[model samples]
Target chain A: MQLTERHRKYWRANLRLTGTLLAIWFAVTFGVVWFARELADIKFLNFPLPFWVGAQGALIVYVLLVRHYARRMNELDEEYGVAEDGR
Target chain B: MSRAFANRIKKYYSFYTGAFVMFVLALAVAEYMGMPDQWIGWTFMAATVALYAGIGIVSRTADVTEYYVAGRRVPAIFNGMATGADWMSAASFIGMAGTLYAKGYDGLAFVMGWTGGYVLVALLLAPYLRKFGQFTIPDFMGARYGGHTARTIAVAGTILASFTYVTAQIYGVGIITSRFLGITFEIGVFVGLAGLLVCSFLGGMRAVTWTQVAQYIILIIAYLMPVVFMSYQVTSMPVPQLVYGTVLEKVTEREEEIMADPAQATARDAYRARAEEIGRAIAALEASGSNGESLAQLRRDKETAEAKARPIHHHAEPFPGETEAERDTARLNFIALTFCLMVGTASLPHVLIRFYTTPSVREARESVFWSLFFIFLLYFTAPAYAVFAKYEVYTNLIGSSIVELPGWVASWAKLGLVKVEDINGDGILQLAELTLNPDVIVLATPEIAGLPYVVAGLVAAGGLAAALSTADGLLLTIANALSHDVYYQMIDRQASTTRRLAVSKGLLLLVALIAAYVASLKPDTILSMVAWAFSIAAACFFPALVLGIFWQRATREGAIAGMLVGLGVTLFYLVGVKFYGMTKWLGITDVSAGIFGIPAGFVTIWLVSLFTPAPDRATLELVERVRYPSLRG
Candidate 1:
């Protein structure tokens, strides 16, 4: 039950992936809301940025974030030989 | 667990979905053939609850593994659907669109926070907990932090938060059931309890998990159908999300036009005069040293006046006010509330337990993705639902002659749920002439869209599924905490597995009944009570659980200190601000009290763990296993 460099490497990779994704998550969550009034005037196709982001865009981003994490982590686990029995 | 078994499950569910759809269509036919709306309502209530109960009976198990975590072999997609159902309470299913309809842009905090929370789950908590492999959240607390004290405290917090949350669900059922079934609220709550008990009592987590998957399907379909129909009805496009912008623009224009109507101003003045009259009466009562009787009368009057209050802000408005001070306050409250909800989503015992049902850490991660996708089906549609329902009102109902108002309005008015009057005696409906309770928008959408009564019945059934699924998970969490954590772990370590199962079932029933009684009492505001539960969960468990995974140095003492500090600050602020009239500190509203408690808990855990002795070698090894899935001893 000794710790190995391999374990540390895998953990580090996982952490890095999580960090990058979360930084984007943090920006999308608060940024859309904070600059909502400003974003509203800068519309794409006549839909106000604030309204679209608050209503729908942020949720779509959430789905994408989790999808990316799940995909990347499984691949990371595979590369590190740490993958569980894929159920 | 095998490929054959998984295929069998897929087949069974496919057949079940087909049958359920056929059943609904038959009901629609019955409605078209002059079947009574009462019969449709009763049929939906009976059939859906019975369907869930039957699944519970079929999935009933005596094996401890099955009882606790469904033998830990549930596939990713099914687990995701179960988690979606588990995550969406009556609040998300029933209240969310209504909230969006009322609060407008501000309501996205609930949507964003709840969905964004799953990101925390997938990235931080879910896979590790599955790697740890336990039946309940407290199991991790006891094993990782290493003591009964931590486990017991975890159990206490789990029960309290789950119980509070479950009562809100049942209370919601009381409203939905009584409204649909024509039963009294008291009877409606017990009916909801019956639905909950039959699902969770028989097979514990196994029953609840499968039933939740079924419930998720019902709820998502129920939520989307009316909304999609309305969107298509209004815009000739079936996709609500795509059509949302156009509908929103139209709604904004209507809001501006309605705001400019002189009759609307007359209505506003009448409301102002009424408010002034009440203020004067209250002042006079206080001057004369008001008696309890007079005070009670005034309180009732105030309540009436408050309910009469109409929306002053437009749906597209950024927040509550145009002033910078108010905008600043709204934004802060929004951010705080979102953070608390995200943490709470990660920490709730019922939600965390869903991860344990997956076969492995990989399934846990996959299931989270699926959960968000499934939940997004409803979340992405809610704002669109709000705007289109608004469109229906703006285009069809408002500015119409009073004599031409629809039958739905007359019926809703008869129930006192909607108020429409020609206050200015113009014989035309102004926006002010209609005071619609936000709750009615989702429920009334089918009829408002000129759909048949059958769709309304379907929506009611979907709402029931949402409440029942969430209630079942919560009830199981509470019962398991008592029977597994308290009784077996503490009182009788060598208790037989059958005995533990029996106790869990009995406690589940007892807890269901108690929650039913509380719901019968009809607490003020399900959303507020639910928010309170979330803050407590966030403060109490979020710090301890996250730290225990990452910081092997988190001793039992540190965990205990963290929980107490977190719970203490949350309850203190909540009680003081909610009950004692304490001015909110830093304008941190009462709902986001956990924003304070979370920081306090994290700081306390860090300081206490450093000050105390480090956890032993075995605990450190356990942390390694959770952190790196490959690092098996």
Candidate 2:
């Protein structure tokens, strides 16, 4: 398992981005749930505010996080001299 | 025949076709004997036991990995089948339909959330975890965080989540048993335990996986048959929700007529006279300027009056009572339960584990599409059966003057599986008038639709399939945590695989006992309990897992902080709010509000990770190694 300077930078960036996104994730879940009534007045694409957050918003974030992680991990693999196949 | 040709012929015929034939034959024989649907449930219980016995004769590996993960060489297709079996437990097959039946449109959240959780597993968690995989969820936590503390916390969380979830499955078994076997609830639990022990403990993972795959097929077919038959009968539409909604229109009309015709109804004079007595007593209270007490009395009288007037039906929803607020509360609770179900589906562990079975990341992605396709087959039919059953109750069984029900009803009632009571004393059975358990909606489908005896038998077989498959998968995970993660990795790193396998088998037995014990204690509801488990998982694992995969600088301290805070918040909202009241604990009025737990976890993880130093270059390389499977084990 060889690690180069490029790997270090990529890893650092990945960590920072993950941390930021996660913080936002928490805010969305707790904030919207606590203020469901207030948010329910707001709608996205015709869904009630709370319903949008609960059903659609949470799912979209999950997809973004997954794509973000997969791409970052692939980049880190390239820098570290480890092939994507782990050969 | 040529040797090569014979082998090819034998391969397809022997394994796949033979098993299919045996299952069909068993089903046919059970149906033929007039053994009833409840007795048909035994076919699954028998098949699972028989499958385990066969696995024991074929495999003799003493290696722990062999027992825990089948030496990690399971073919992708076989693994997918097993995973399907693992994912579609009793809750999915039995409880889901009933919920949709009772809740209506709001229940889509459950189906969507559950299937969507697989997407998270495929792209985000599974491949990487498989790359880094050793045994248990705690193993990943311990390795990523680099410590015994992280591992210990992960293990505790897994146990908490797994144990709570498994208890619900056990409770399901008990309910099914009491319904099918003419047995006491205690005996039902015991019967469920005995079957689980044979399917899981006797064979360990090696046996459990294969058996689970079989169970999945049985359960899925069982779940589908009744819904399909019912859908065909009503509206000729195969879609479940449409059938349910269509029946809703019919039921609403009947209810309206009953409400209007109460004044001129000739039947139920006895109950109507009693209701008048109660109604007058309440009217006197209202005349005395006692609004609060008078309202309570009036509400009770209303129930009595509705019962008398609607003596021809059984399962009526409570009428619009005195207070608008109370009616709104019922509607609100229905909405909240639906929300909990949808969100919680994304957080289940056993379901998450299924994605790991796929060989490539792409395959994982495709498999989910297949799963959703397979799931939709029954999912669309569920509401149909639910509504059809409700309509059956309303139309025929409610207030009819027949002391004995029609053949199917009498038969099911004789099994004590579907009980009835003459609530309004009209001597007629109103099927809709019965207070049906949500769990029984799918289970009771064959009887409700007046399907052939064999169809009813098939329905029972399906419930058993769903229950046992899920039980086996959960038991295997629990066993791995004890044997591979705790005993081998943490306590004794140098322990031989053979010794570890022994411990894993022992743990399987112990956990099965514990689950059986917990199931006997009985919880509030299977669906709600499942939600509690999921919310706890989302609070604890989802954040940590997401962060671990994407963030290279995620510190041990940060991960730990995030998990603790998230779990604490989820628990406070779930248990604390229930016991202490939301006002005293968090000053929040709505219990459906998950409060601050999810965000609290995310923040704690991020801030703590930032404050701590990043992983060393060596650990970063390990992360790289795990990301790519061809990088070498």
Candidate 3:
């Protein structure tokens, strides 16, 4: 039950990664969607920026956020000697 | 992938592909044999139900663990597909494009909120819950909080949220069944309910999961085929997903042109003249001091006149806000709606439970990624469907002579789904003369484009698949909560596995019957009811589940208190503002009731935890174990 230095390091790394990814999540979802109207004045690939972002860009970003979190968490698990054996 | 995993994928792939090919051949034969449209629709409905029922029967198992969690052996990719089907209910499949067609940019709240919530699921809940490895969400609550009281509260929240959600799905089933089978809506509810019970009650979660995978295939194909065909028709481009940007630009240009046309201006003037006449008539009735019945009659007439006039005045535009205050409210509404939906998606019990069926924590994470990937296939195509459907309507239908309008319009008008009155007496379809229920857009698309009648039947089957897949998952969640969480765990405490499984099956039937009766009543539109369900889930369960995993200091008392307050406040606000027309509290509407309840729950849990004693050492250790899998006992 005792918390060791190794556990503390793994936990801190996980939290930091989670925090950073969440910030990006907030920026893409809320930040981009809220300012979508202002971004409409700009065009991307011949489509309105906000429209393209709202319709497609935000979702792709969300998928990447999840994929990154999974890969990083797996790395953290292995580094801390806690990874599943893939039974 | 491992050899075993690859083989499982190949097995299911070959099975589904064979089934799909056979169904297509049957449909082709039916068409070539010159079956009537009614017969074709009935055949599609019957064949699909038979296919699902067959899968359910084959996968049926009486083992308690398998019944509850599919034996926790589902491969990641397959689980992801099943979850995607469960997640994309009737609201996503049937109503999403219609909403986009009607609301334009504002409706992207649904798109963003739903898909974005997967991130929250992957990071905040699914992996840890999978590591906990419980049969149900309430099981985690009970063990983590160390008492039956927490479990009971958690069960109550799950039932309330799941029941509301399942009712909407059942309502969607009724709509699809009645429209396709040419039966009454009540009859459709019973038929759909029968299909739902057979698929869910026979094998429980095991049957439902496999059936859901098959349903996902049907729904995705049914949804994409018409839209892709339409896209090609419009832009000579085969990829609707890529070509829609040009369609959107064209739609905007056409809207601007229509707004400036003199013909539109004349139609608007005529609509205004009718509205003025109605207003004068209403004033005359009021001035004469007519009786209440006559006054009511006059008001109804006025409403009819206005309904006929409004669309001409505001056709196919983003939510119109003439003032700064109104614009601000619209923006706030958009943000509030999206935030609530995101949290709600993460907190839904049925969705959360799907993660528990994954084989490991890593697979749980992978499953979330695949679920979003499968869902994106549909979400990416929805806006294109809306744009192309709108383009078709704006270019071809509006301004056509009423007699020359497409045959589908007359047929749909007969069913009251589309209305055309030729209000200007020009014998032509003015924009004002035409109105449509948004639900019919997806259903009517194939016919509008003059595709084979069988495509319409295929679309109906797809809609049914969407509704039934979600219903199966939700019904199982409610049944498990009742039989496992309450009956065996709380009441008996010594029930055998067989007995528990039997009880769960019985409870599933009872719940399905009740949901069907509610669906028969036709309570609300599919999307609105779904929104309400999401708000309830977000408000009640989101805080407890998220904080329980992340915040080691969170106590049982705090969790229990937060759940009760959150559920109570959300239900109170929704019932008050929505049903009774009470003024919104803090300018927050019922759809975003979570705006008030979520924070209250989070703050209450944090504040109360700060003042209370810390949880026992064992409980803290369990939290650590859930957080770090290597430490699991």
Candidate 4:
């Protein structure tokens, strides 16, 4: 099961995207919750910033992250000529 | 699926949606035309259950693939909706707003943790596993690890976790049924069990998937109606998610007013004195060394106080801690619980199996996104629902004369879900004097908003759908463990498809009946076991499943040891906290016991795999095939 340069390149790109999205994930989930008291002083759209983050912002970000990954991977599969449909 | 196939599905379901809408409208019209409230409730419950059962009958099958994985052709959006219904149990549908109402900012832990798990699934699991193409998680265990032992262990693990999980859902069924249908709880348990059976027992995943899609529609609509209506009434805004601060301002003022009012202070003192008097009586009985009926009665009184004790909470606070040390522990507990839920969500067997029904690796990843999106609809509005409910109580219910209180209050109080006490000898209701259980907040929402009886019926129907959908999945997961993994895979490898399906159906009926009986006993222990299911799944499969897919060097021995170690640590921590008089580790509750097990599992897998010989080439190739979405045959 030797890997070609094309395979290596696609895997690397996928990993990079996942790492970047997960970084945003960490910041949103733990960082926002951890500093919620301090962030409460700030307001966004007339809602307390931390409250908004916990209730809606973080969830929206999660949805986008997954969607972006799925779309990117599909394109990557096509570009690498490795898609299930043999693009 | 091909475009034409997708178009046909859309055409058929469009008609279904229209018919569902028509049924509800007709019921509403019937209510307007002097239909008895009891009859409206009966009609709503019966009509929805009958429709689901009809879908089940139409989808009935002896084909193994269709029964187990819905022919692996479910569309992305429908699978997503079904997954949403499957993921949302009684807890999410009926209890979330109530939790949000009670816990305020801290309660978002559940919303974030549950939804965030789908991200983990998309990145780390769904695409790879869907590419692997298995009937169940245990099938993956057997194939990847190349043995029956790992598969057997997984079957046992699946049955253990999913059985308790199903029992809890049945308990929810009983609760909602008794509340709305005016039946006893025991009868409700069996009645709801029949509805659950028709969906999964007949058509298997094919039926359950479609049934769940229909259920997701009812539940999301039912959940949103009261929230949207109340938001319009309070702030003249129909979209509840965006109108947060508008209602919060009034709620804040009321909180301050309640805090400063002398009558509230008097109410608090009265509560303390009453609790103290009961405590003193119990102490006297114990000091007398009497094991008489009087002593037992006093003990029950004390337990009642302990059960109803609502700790003081500030609606705006993030995490409550009076001191720096307590704050640190609170922070630790919150993060720990969130992490545990995220891992558990990825590893849950009932949820993981949903991915196998998708047509391809790409759809699996996309469906995870849809799952999160559909779930996000409700999670986003739950906080606003809580805030608006609080505003209503603060502005309208509180400070009103007790005798003149709204009929909704008396109605809920009759069920003992809402307790009102005139603690200060004043007839006026104070915020402190009213204790509303979490179930009351959601179930009573329609009544609180002065909505028609049909809307209340609709809410109850939504709750039934949520519970039934989850229960249907759990029942199948458990039955499959015995029938598919054990009987078909291990015991009767040469059995016909018909025989195998029959065994599965029989096992399913048996398991559902057992769960119903356990739920009927009204044991509080099942509720606690429900919390343990997440931890159990998190510990048993998270590390093994992840490494089995990603790391080719992961050996059979390594996986088994990791799962066992993880399971051992989780049970140890849970038992230690529950019965061994052990303090919580860094204030982490037993619900999140996976906090300890997950790390222990990862570490154990690393150490064990390093010491053991690497797996053979075929097994390693299986891992590679699973990891890459576009691998050539």
Q: List the residue pairs that clash in candidate 1.
A: none
Indicate the docking level reached by candidate 4. Answer: medium
Each model's lDDT comes to 0.85, 0.62, 0.84, 0.87
In Å, residue B469's CA in model 1 sits off its true spot by 0.4
Write down the RMSD of candidate 1 (Cα, Å): 1.9
Q: Which lDDT value does model 1 have at B41? A: 93
lDDT of 4 at B63: 96
For model 1, chain A alone compared with the true chain A gives a TM-score of: 0.90
Q: Write the per-residue lDDT of candidate 1 for residues A1-87, one digit (tens) a residue.
A: 886787778888887998899898899888778877766667754477877776677778888999999888988888888776545
Please give, for residues B224-252, the per-residue lDDT of candidate 1 as tens digits. 99988888888899988887888888888
Model 3: residues >4 Å from true position, as ranges? B1-6, B269-319, B524-528
Q: How does chain A of every candidate compare to the true chain A by TM-score?
A: 0.90, 0.68, 0.91, 0.92
| Per-candidate RMSD, Å | 1.9, 7.8, 2.6, 2.0
Least well predicted 10-residue stretch by lDDT in candidate 4 chain A:
A78-87
DockQ value of candidate 1? 0.67
TM-score of chain A of 2: 0.68
Off by over 4 Å in 1: A85-87, B292-311, B525-527
DockQ, each predicted model: 0.67, 0.11, 0.59, 0.65
Candidate 1 residue B611 Cα shift, in angstroms, is 1.3
* Residue B142 accuracy (lDDT) in model 1: 89
TM-score to true structure, per model: 0.97, 0.75, 0.94, 0.97
Weakest 10 consecutive residues, lDDT, candidate 4 chain B? B304-313
